[model samples]
Structure formats: C-alpha cells, structure tokens
Target: MRKKTPLNKQIYLSDHYTGNIAKTFQREKDINILQWDFSVEASLVVKLQIESLLNYIVKNVKSKDERRCKYLLPLQYLFRYVKKNNITDILKMEIRQEKEYELFVPKEVKKNSGSLRKFIEFCRRILFISNKEIDWSANVWYVEGLHINPKRVSQGTPILSFSFLDITNSDNRKALQEYVNYLICVTSMKMNTIRIRQTYARDFFRYLEQCNLCIFDVDYQITVKYMKKLGTQNLKSQSYNIKLNAILEVIQYLQTRNYIARFEIPVLYHKEKEIHTVNDIYNIDEKLDILQKYLYLFPETLRIMCLVLINTGVEKGKMFLFRDTDFYWEEGTSWLRIPGENRSIPIPSILYWIIIQYMKRNKLTFDAQLFHNERGKKYSTASFADAVSKQCSKLGILDGEYIFKGSMYQRELCRVLYRSGTSLQAIREYMGYSTEEVVKDIVGWKDEKVAIKTQEFFEDEKHNLGGKLLMAKHDKMKEINQLESLHKVDFALQEIKNYKDSGRIISVTELSRKTGLSKGFFYKNDRVREALDEVKNEQKEEQLGIIRKEIIDYSLEKQLEVYKRELEKTKQENQLLKRENEKLKKALDKQTLQYLKLLAET
Candidate 1:
C-alpha cells in the first residue's frame, strides 16, 4: 500500500513549492501571528494546485486576513463542489456572480447590505483568473460591473460627493462633468481636496440652478448671491473661510478657463471674535496622563485609531480606508503609508509598540483591517470621531470650538510640533498643507516665517526679477500688471470689510455716500460688490428676524405647550415602568423558589 500523505502538510506544501508567507518574505516581518492550523483531505494533484494558488495569493496580497477572507472560503467551496461531483480535475469549478450575489447579499445574512457588490470589487482587485488564464473581466466584470458603481459613501463631514446630474443646464452639466473627470480625477489634487471642491462646486451649481442661470454665462451678480447665502450660514469663521476659499478656487479655475467672467473674492470679512492663546492647549498633564494608559488599555480598534491620528496627521477619512497592509514596518520603524501621498509618515516609537501590541491582541495578520469593527468592516469617520470626542469630553480635553469633527488629533499633534520648534515646511508637510501661510494659520504659530520680511526689499524691478534668463521681460510685466490689479481690488475689498468690522453699516447707499463713490463703481467692482451685498443681506436677515419675532414667540408658545405635554406623558410612563419593575421583581422571586425546588429534587 502507498504511504498516506500528512493532511495538514498537504494543504500548504503539496507539489506546490512556491513558498510559505513566512519563509517567502525576505524582510523578516513579525508574522508569527499569522500561522494557523490547516487540515483538509484532497487528491494530491488538487492539493498541489490549492497550495500553488494560496502561495501566489499570500505572496502578492498585503493582508493575510484579506487573502484568507476572499480566497479560503471560495477555495473550500470549490473543493467541496469538486469532490462531491467526483470531478477528475478541480480546475473546472467556476463562480458565477448571479448565484454568488444571491447567497452573499440576501437579507438572511447578518445586516450585510451591498456586500456582494464589495465582493465583486474584491474580485476585480485580485483578478479572478483560472490557471488556464481566462479573461473574465471582458465577460463578467465589464458587463455586470458597469452597474456596480458604489453609492456616495461619505466617511465624514468634509468628504461630500455631489451628484452632478442635479444640474439642469446642459452646458453647466457638461462643464461640471469635465471638471470632476478631468480636473479632479486626472489632476494631482489630493482626495480630500477633490471632495471639498466637489461639495462647493455642487453648492455653486445648485445655487445657479435655483437662480435659473448658466455657468457659461456666470457673472458677478450670482456670485454675490452665493456670498450672501454663505454669510447667513451657522459655520464658524474659520470653517466659513475654508468653505468659501474652496469654492473660490473653483470659481477662479472657471474664470481661468474663460468659461465664466473673472471676479475677485476675499475669504472672510469677519473680525477675529476671540484671540487665540496658549491656554487653548488646555491641561496638558491631565490629558497625557489619561491618554498614555488609555492608548494601551483601550480596545485594539480604538487604541490604534487614536494612536495613528496622534502620531500621523492623516485625516479621518483616510483612516477609514486603511488596510492592515498600510501599516508598513521596516527594521524598527513603522510607517503609515497611505496611497496618493508622496511621503510615508513615520510613527513615533512608543505608538509603534502600542500599535503592534494592539494588532497582536486582535490577531491581525497582514490581511485584516487596521480600524475595523468585529465584523471586519470600518466604521464611518463620523462614528469614529464621535467615539474620540466622547472620550475626550470625559477627560475634559475636548475643544469647545473644534474646526473639524475629528480635529482632536490634529490639534494635539500641532501643539507637540509647535512646542518642539519643528519648521513650518515640515509642519506643512506633516499636516498636508499646501501653503506655509495655511500651516501657520492652522497651528496658530505666531511667527513671521511665512510672512513677507519687508515689502520694500524687492522694490527694485531688477532685484525682484530673479536670474531666470528664460523668463521674458513681458512675463515680468504680466506678473506686475496682475499684482497691481489685484492690489487695487483687494484694497477696496478690505476697506469694505474694515467698514463692516467697525460695526459700520455698508448698504449700497451708505457705502456710496460715505466713500463719495458712485453707485455704479461700487456695484461694478466684483469684490466690493460681493462684500457689500453680503453685509446688506446679513443686516436684512437680522431685521427680518426681528420683524418675524412675534411668529417665533407664537411658535415657542406652542412648543412650550407641547413640551409640557411630553413631560407629563414621560412622568406617567416612568410611573408605569416602576409598577412593571415591581411585578417583575415578584415574578423573579417566584422563579427562584421553583429553580431551588427543581435543583433539590435533582
């Protein structure tokens, strides 16, 4: 009789000597956590094929969890189907999306909505090809996958996706489509930036639709309308400026393309309501004491989530998209390597240890996600942010005026960097700010590093013109002309803003009369016009709210009556709950006697 092969060894190292995940890796990753027992009976040749496939998958795949999750179950199903059918060759087993979709996406499964679609994407990523090399994408994915587009899965407040189809004008629709496809997708802009642009672009387009105007003929009037709408919003001044600037960039892009008439707009005209001080950092000793232990003792998902945010200044949305593979370790250093970013963020040594410990506790192989729930799916950014916020609130470290939902990490990290005397460029790089000024502003760094040293230093034309022999004189002229034009416009805009900041009313009549400027000039100058209109509209809304106060009072009276009724109903329900609790307590005592009697009899 032929000697029987060991079943467990047969599963991984049959005739397929491609390699094991541990031995195959040249760089010694601490992957002992990935080893698992395996035992399956199969034909020698079939086992060989299985081993070969597994090696190929394990070698190329980033996460052990993903490799096993996507392949192992399917492979088992294939083995069962083949053995039951008594097929000579196991290669003929093929998965059809239709039946698989039915099995995976059915409501009978535990709340796994659209998981079949996710599976389809997972399949696409791995490329479901047979050993014979079948081109399945041509038949399966391209045909069925055309309709498998993901819904706008917003991770957090900032990553908003807009449906451009909402725009009614054909020209506007075409332009916006091109903007999304060509400008956003094809260009080198970051994903967060792209999303921000999409949000405000949609807002601008929707505003245009409401006014029954076309973007191709976008003029100064509708921009004023847009500014006026923005002015009445409940956004904080910084957030207000961020949104306004994002929208303004797109408007500038449109004007640059000559699709719309050019206009200048300032980010914000609002004065600083409160001065920022070092006191904003708040109770450093208490926060560190809480977080140091909390970071180690908390659940793997929460600890690693907080650890990453604190160490690396990645946005929360990017954290949601993290796979365990993204946590790349080399030698002793660990890096959070997100796609599309040029730099690999080095994790702090202490946090790296914590991260590894957390991963090991959770039994995370290279296949599992870094920040997923027990179900192996990520929570939304908002959900994660709420968790962070709640924890911070309990610690009394939560900022009263948070700029972003999940800003605790960024704020703390910036504090550490600023205190460490890290350079503005380095801070900008870490925080992913494009400009030095932005980095300074966000971190509240009170330094003139990004500011112009002296305006008079480059007063001479020759000194201003660098030794770039290729730069034509006319180019310099163009630059100077643009600056002069922008300066003139900015001065007027700032004047309007200053007037408003001083609590001076700036209506068309008031502004024109005060400055002795013509109404036509005030209305014609786009920057002056928009700022003036925003101030007027805000004042008008204030007056309107005052005039409408009686209606508000009547509504409040009705609300008060409703509140009283609700309070009475809630009190009655609580009383009913008390009686029900007493009944339940008596029943529990009766059940205890019955259990005691039964146990005594036994």
Candidate 2:
C-alpha cells in the first residue's frame, strides 16, 4: 500500500530541493478509487517490451507478488490508464494534454498533471530511448517535473543501462546492481549517500560508454581524463572534491576486487577547511543571535537538538544516536555522553528541562532511542539537516561561508569563549573532540596559556600602544627593520611585559590583529621561537647588568667613606701616643739631668 508519505522519496525530493512537490504528493489525496496492483496479465508484446523494468522492480521491491505493495501502487494505476485509454493505438500526441490526464469514471483529475511524466520516464528506462528522441511538448507536466531534472536514482537493480556501461554485458549490469545492494544493506550507508552515489555512477558510466570503454578498460589515465573535464564545473573546491572522490571510490572498489587496475586517487586541498581561527569563533553578539531562537521560539524537538549540538558538538547522526540513558539528569546536576568522545559533559538546566518535556511528550523511557524520524524509524540525516536548515534560514542567519552543522556550532561557540578570554584547553575539553588538533583545526587556538596573553596591553585606554609599548622596546619606532629578533620570547611575554610596564593588554587577539599573524602562528613557529627566546634572554641580561652596576656604585661609595673615617681615627690615636711618648722622653731628660747616673742605669 502507498504510505502516507514515502520516507525515501522525501529524502530524494529534499536533496534535490524539490520543495513543494513532496507536499503536493502527500497532502493532495484527491483520488482513492485507484487500485495498487495490476489485475490483468500484460500482453506478450507489452511483457516483452517491459521485461527489464519488471525484472528490475522485482529485485528492487521484494513484495512484487503482494497486493498493495507500496512501490507497485503507482504502476497499477498506470496499467489501468493504459488499458482504459487504449493508449496502444498510438496518436501523433503532437498536442500536449492541457492537463496530463482526465480520469473518465469519476471525471476528476489532478489540477497540474497526471503521473504521466513519471510513467514516461519509466518507459524510457524500459525501452532505452535516448533523451534526444523524446518529445518535450507531448507531456503537460514536462516543465514542472522534468525542468528540475531530478536525477534518476539507481535502485540496486540492473533495470537501466548507462551508455558507458556495455548494454550487451549483462554480467556487468548484474554486478553493479549487486554492489549497490551490498552498499545499502551491509555498509549501513545513509539513503542520501546512496542517491548521490547513484547519480555519480550514472555520470561516470555514461562517460565511459561515450569513450567506447568499460570498467575493464579503465586505468589511471582514463580517470585523469575524466577529472580534467570534471575540473571545469563551477563548484567549490570542497564540493568538487567530494564528487571526484565518489567516482574514485567506485573505481577503487572495482580495483580492490581485481576487476580493474589499482591507482592512487587524487586529493583536493580546500584551504577553508584547514582550521577555524579565533575569528571563526563568534563573539557574544553572534552567539546571542544564533542561540536566542533555541531559548525562546523554536519547536521543542528543534530546541533540544540545537541545545545538544551547541553543548556537545556532536554531529546529526551521533546526536540522534543517543539513548535516553545517555542523559543523566537528576536532583540539581546533569550531564550526557556522546559515544566515542570519551567522557560526559555538564549540561545547562534549561536543556535538561527541555529534554525531560520532550521525553514526556513522546513517552520515551530511559532505554528508548531519544530521537527518531517522522515515520518512527531511526533518525535520518536528511530529515534532521532539513529541520535545522529551515530554522536557520528563518532566522536570516544562514551564510554561504559556513554550513550550520554541528561542527559550525562548535566553531562559533568556541569563538565566543575565545573572544571572552576563555582558555583553549577549556574550550577543547568542552567541545568533546578526541584530539587537540581536531579542536585546533576547528578553532585555531594553538596554546591555551599563550594564545591570548597579549590582550592586556590593548585593554588599557590610557596607554599609547605605538609609543609606550613597541616604540619603547624599539627605542622609538615600530619599524620592522629597526627591531631584529628583540621582542618575541613567547607571544605572551611581550603581552606580559606590556602588562607589567603599561598596566594594560587588551587581548592576545587584538595583538594578533596588530601583527597580522594568527595567534597560533606565534605560538606554533618553533624555529623562530628559539631565536625569540635567545633575544629575550639577551634583553633580560642587559637589564640585570644595569641594576647590578647601580648596586656596585652605591656599595663602593659607602666602603670608601668608612675606610677614610678609620684612617682619620688611627691618625688621631697615633698623634696622642706620640705626644705621650714625647712627654715621657722630656720627663726622662729632666730625671736624667737630676740623676744622669740613674737614667743611664735605667
């Protein structure tokens, strides 16, 4: 039976940006009398003509023999139309249907077009008619349906053949189908990925057919030739690279199985992904702008998702992978685990309340998967991304430079902290990435301690940065030629010294702006850093020498004064002793005069 809304079709339409049609398909349940399977046996000619389509659909949909099989619903109506209109009679069909079809019995029809456009596409696949042979004006739905040119997704069945893949080689087609099925079931790949791979495979296979070659004939040279043409597309490096890799994977798979020769795949360098700088981390204003919707107006589901993404930095897949038990909320404290991130992290009270309310509404228990898609199946990437995307657009915050994924949340959140003087280590721990490098790549803060140390000099309003800081260090000016390896010990040291001498450093970030180098660059450049250290030591020694000289001058002056006082006192004492000696001699002389003999005897 036809579903209320087809999940795979929703993903298909969303990925193609097939916006309103999906709603049209689901909401406009205009007719209910149509059967969902063919009752009459197909004529021999019709059966022979649709042999491949039938075979493909049979393999693709296992419930082919069952009544009301969802995939067969559209086809059952198609067969009824074919027989009712006696369409086999063949008209010039030179005139387009004003509307695609007008059902006879109920005399009702879809306002736009019947499912004729889809039927025609199915016919083309069955018959292998080239695009050029098809008449565009014959179908009323031509513009609305075909103009968008949604890719014909491969269904892991050998129903349709690309020109590049040999039409006569039934084995190749079967193998490709088997491969696609394996990818879907065993690889646990996402549906969107399956569609994309299908699209890429079609393009590559068609190109191979044009070149008069097959997978067996493929080599590095052929792939290189293909890439040279691929390089012409106006996609961004990242997008272009992803497309290239998709094709490479197909070829690589073939090579791994010894069906083709092995070769190294080319790699593209998208400079923007290198790492987010401190700048990519947003300031308070930006953070407030992004987070305010979650705080107040967004739906509960979206709010909780945004909160978790903002807090834990987990991607959509892993964010949805969590069970209720992963969240530990009780009493006054709360935390949750994002598997593979290694530890639990504290959550805000508001988030806890939101999750509890959501769980209660959904009747979720501790063991239930906390999130799911609309069909009550496991959470799907396309649905979650679409939900987030719509909200971001409504807020008028979507930007071409950044995608609003979980990683972007991390970058912006970390940026806010970085701007506010939060340490890198703290931000990294909070972000929950396994490696510091991953945090650094996402938000480039190389050293938590040194990253923002220079901020104080710029913080003080009274100091003239050019005059009081760099100029004094350079003896008067900010000329690069004049200062040779003199100022950098650590990027932080200059900031530290600036803070000490001038009592202000606005931010390491501001100093980084002044120097026109990333904060991480100064922190990470080892070769230049060693020289910077030597220069710092030299400056320290010179300052120490001047202090030492002043102390020696003061000490020597005091010692000289003490020596002079001691000499003077000694002289006075010697004079007194001399006087006493003279007195004694005079007395001796008088005594000698009185008693020359006594004196001589003495």
Candidate 3:
C-alpha cells in the first residue's frame, strides 16, 4: 500500500504567499483544509494548478469576496475519486467528455466543475504549450502576461483571445499579435479600446476562416462579403457602423505596414433610425421627473452617483474615480473638479449637502475613493449600471421608457442647462469637453422650440398692426388732399436736404415745421416721402463709410508697422555684413602692402 501524502505537504502553504490577500487568504486556507481528503501525488499536481489559479484571482479578480477558496473544490474531488478507483493516469482523463465527467465527478462537486473547466481552459491557454515567459502563439493572451499594466479597473483586466484564427494560420496570428502590441506600445491606446478593436479584428478573422481566406488575402470583394454577413446579424445602424469601422481600421493598418496590398474598402455611413418627435421630448421631461421622485428608492451608492451624474454630467468611466478632495467650496458655492481637467463645475447646494452627508456616513478620507462597493473596492461602471437598471426595473420603469445610463443623465442635464439659458460655451466648460459639438446635439431641440414660438409671435403681431393701419387711413387721406392743394413738394425736398447736410434727425415733424407742410403730407405724398427716406439712408451710409475707412486705415497701419520692423531688421543685418566686408578689405590691403615692402627689401 502506498503511504498517504500529508495535506500540508501536497499543497503549498507559504507564509510569503499569505501576504497576497493577508487575513482573508489565511482564513480561507484554514477553513478549506478541514475538508481536504488524503493527498496523493496526483492530488499534489492538482493542488499546484489550483494554487496558480488562486494566485491569479488574488491578483486580478475584481471581486473582494473572501470565499474564493471554493474554486479548489472541483479539482480536489477529481483527484480523490481517481485515486479511489485506482485510475492509471491522472492527467489523461477526458474530463470534457460527458460520460467520463459524469463517472469521475461526484454529484456534490459537479456544480463547481464548471469552474474546474475554466481552470482547465486557463491551463490549455497558458501552460500546456511551451512554458516560456510569454507564449505569443497561444490562443489567449493576458495583458498582465505581456508585462503590461493595462490600467487597473474596477472590472477585471482585458484579455485578448486569438482562437478565431485558424490553427494552421500561424502567420495571421503573429500579425494580429504585432498589431495589438502596436496599439499597446506605440499608439498607447486605452486597454478598453484595444480590447474592443481586437474583438472586431477577431470577428473578421473568424469570418475569413469560414470563407477559407486569411488577412493577407483581403480585398474589396472580401470587405463587401463581410459587410453582407454583418447585415445578416440584425445589428443596429450605429452598432453596424462601429463594427465596420473597426474592421476597416485593422485592414488599413495591415495595408499601411505593407502586410497586405492596398485596396479600397467602400466608405459607408450609417443612418440613425432614431427620430425624436415632440412626444419624445415630453417623455424625456417625464422621465427626469420620475427619476427625481423615485430617487430615494435607489441603493445608497447608486443614488448619490446618479445625482452627481445628473448635476455635473461626468462620464461613467470617471464617475468612480472621484476622490473626497475632488469636491471643494469656491466663492461660497460647492464645486466638483473633473479628473484630468483643470476646471471645476458648480453643483447644487442640496446635491452638495447630500454628498457631504454620504461622505460622513461612509467616513471617506481626502484621497480615498468617494464611491466604492461594500468591500471598499471601487464599483465597476457595468456593475453600477446594472444595479441602477435593476432598481429602476423593480420600480416598474421599463428600459424603453427610462434607462438609468450615465450618458442619459448627462444629456438630460445638458438639455436642462440649455433650456435655462446657459450658453453653449459655458456648457462645454462645465461638462469638461473641448468642443460644444456634442452639447449642441443634446440642446438642439430647444432651437426648434424657439423658432416655432418666434414665428407664432410675429404672425399675431402682423394681424394686429394691419387692423391699426386700416383704422388710421381716413385721417391720412384728408391730410394728403390738403398737402396736394398747397403744392409744397419743392419746399419739403429743400428742408430734407438741409437736415441731411446738418446731420439732423430727418422725420415728418421736422420737415413739417421747416416747409410749413402737414406731417400727414410727408407721410402720404409718395415723392416727398421717398426723397426724405433717401436723404436719411444716405446720411447713415456716410457715417458707416467713415467707420469703415477708419478700420481700413488701422489695419494698414498695423501692416506698415510689421513692414517697418522687417526693414529695420534687414538694415541691421546689412550693417553687420558691411562691417565684416570692410574689415576683410583692410586685412587684404595690409597683406598686399607687406608683400610689396618685402619685394622692395629683396
């Protein structure tokens, strides 16, 4: 009979490893070891794999839960069952086969076998191949494995998978690796962006494999076929555009680097299916009201987060990056500083009060994360969004009616600010955007409202003015008949020219006083009125012309100053050159005189 292996000996219990998760890891080991059975050499092998997985979880898993030791259960059960049945080989077991899994795995441990399968997958991806520093040829590549930080996130790190590449097509896989590395090292693209681009590229690679082609074989026809395939997937217009653009960017990169021949991919623009009617505008207001009313029902963290989002329009990714010091009081108003921006936006006093209370309740420090999960880990954007969605759903809010996305709150805030008469420039500054282009889109509906109201106002005023003019017509006719009988046309024309020359205000009253004509005659006589109006316009034009000439003269003066400065610089340079020329000539003359003297002496 074989000697029973000690549990402690079979599994590594290094004190140094205890420093990874400190107390939680040590406690988990103590609790889990009580459940461990006899440890054979096969069990030792399985434990080592489990140790590696645990190390990965400790370092990379976003969850702060302490019960991560459960991942070890499935492997422990497998190795014990194998030893009990006198299995010949531990490593050769077909755990993926349904019959073999059902036979080898116990009923209690079967549920966790999925996690075990993940471990096996992890092994196949990382270990089974050449056990070097980095296996570039592997199907899955981890950002950490390539010695990249990839920026820590509340969500786990990004992993790039190349399994879509055909196994025989190692050349394509290598090219893909080079492209991804270029994105990481040369371009320094955000890891999330790189991951998404890799996903798009992978989908294209998978499509190429189906068509029995490779990346190097891409051309205009392949692009068309790929687009047709994407069309069949029933993707939304914007989503389809993004995927199309991502693939095109990859193809362009491949061509730019001379890996593939240059070819034109058809430039396609996606038309959005969304059309905002008046009803949609009404719906947005209704949703904003609903959000404010039912806000108390949200989870505490999400509630404060949404309030900040609605007020400041901070981006989702930057939402959780806020520190307690990010909020400060300036000019007796509370301000929130945007991360990575030099500016701060004012927040409502009530919102500020709420945030302060929340900070006090949570006992957050100056530099500590203001928003975090229950375990004091920063909450991922996806997790926070899901939480908000779930809460809203519980309150009978449908996704179509009002989703609690961060961007939705942002757009709504922009709409509110614009309607409150905030300028686009101010909005851009408050939102920490370099341009107002996106803000214009969010607040664009207000322009339509303004235009409609203005047209209605003008239409109403036109009708009222027409009625007033009709009522005053008889008095004007009586005055016009009197003026025609008096024959004062020449007199009125002379008075108008005098007014123009003296730069006096030309009106009917002034003309009536000078020419002894009725004001109504000046108003009603077409020729006299035309002459008066022309004189007034000419005077205004003369003033404007004087101003224009002044502006032109000032501009010419500026140009002249610039030319004079250049001329002065040129004169200085010429003087320096002349001095040097004179010095050289004197030196040459002196040398000639010395040569002549030397010839005389000879």
The 10-residue segment of model 1 with minimum total lDDT is 139-148
**Candidate 2, residue 288: lDDT:** 38
Better of 2 and 3 by lDDT: 3
C-alpha lDDT of all candidate models, in order:
0.57, 0.52, 0.64
lDDT of 2 by residue, 378-472 (tens): 65555666766676667666441224443566676676566545666877787655666765665555564355664555444455456556546
Count the clashes in each prediction.
6, 17, 0
Model 3 CA lDDT for position 240? 79
Task: Report the C-alpha lDDT of model 1 over 500-543, residue by residue, as the tens digit.
Answer: 78876555545555666655566556776677778767865665
Question: Which ranking of candidates, highest lDDT first?
Answer: 3, 1, 2
Q: How many clashing pairs does model 2 include?
A: 17
What lDDT score is found at residue 191 in candidate 3? Answer: 70
User: Could you estimate the TM-score for every candidate?
Assistant: 0.38, 0.42, 0.51
Clashing pairs in 3: none
Which residues of candidate 3, in runs, are more than 4 Å off? Answer: 1-114, 117-138, 144-168, 212-223, 236-242, 256-282, 329-331, 340-343, 360-368, 372-378, 397-400, 418-424, 436-441, 444-602
Residue lDDT tens for model 3, 238-299: 77778878887888888888878888754644333534443244455457656766889887
User: Highest TM-score among the candidates is held by which one?
Assistant: 3
Per-residue lDDT, model 2, residue 166, is: 29
